[model samples]
Target: MDKKPDHTGYWRTNLKYLLILLSIWFLVSYGFGILLKDTLDNISLGGFKLGFWFAQQGSIYVFVILIFVYVRLMNKLDQKYGYREK
Candidate 1:
């Protein structure tokens, strides 16, 4: 009998990472940009208020970083689970 491909574990791990990364994205974008704007505005970053920077530039940078992080995490997960394409 042939063994069925087991993807549930891999999918679960993928979803977990996605949820965590998305939560971080949401916190950085919404929390810093809007909810905590007043507090972060008191801090200056190269002539731009911290909150404004997060709203305009910081979040984008973080999102890019998160993309790389997700890629790396998935690669490792694939290797660990023997799911990588030969």
Candidate 2:
């Protein structure tokens, strides 16, 4: 009989990271970009309003960073669970 791959723990960890990253994405994209735009616009970044930057560029940068972070985290998790591919 073939043994099933035991990945429940790994799956849960991945889900948790996904949720956390998504929450941050939402907050940066919507909260700072729209809801708090007026307040954030007072701050300046590279000759642009902070709020505009978040909506246009900052959130994208953060998302890219999050993707790298997720990859690193998952790799570590895989190693911990002996699930790393050769």
Question: Which predicted model would earn the best TM-score?
Answer: 1
Tens-digit per-residue lDDT, 5-24, candidate 1 = 56898899999999999999
List, in order, the clash count of every candidate structure: 0, 0
- Candidate 2, residue 65: the lDDT equals 92
Model 1 lDDT vs. the true structure? 0.93
Candidate 2 C-alpha lDDT tens digits along 1-86: 85555689779888999999999999998998899989999999999999999999988999999899988988988877778576
Pairs in steric clash, model 2: none
Q: Which is the leading candidate under lDDT?
A: 1
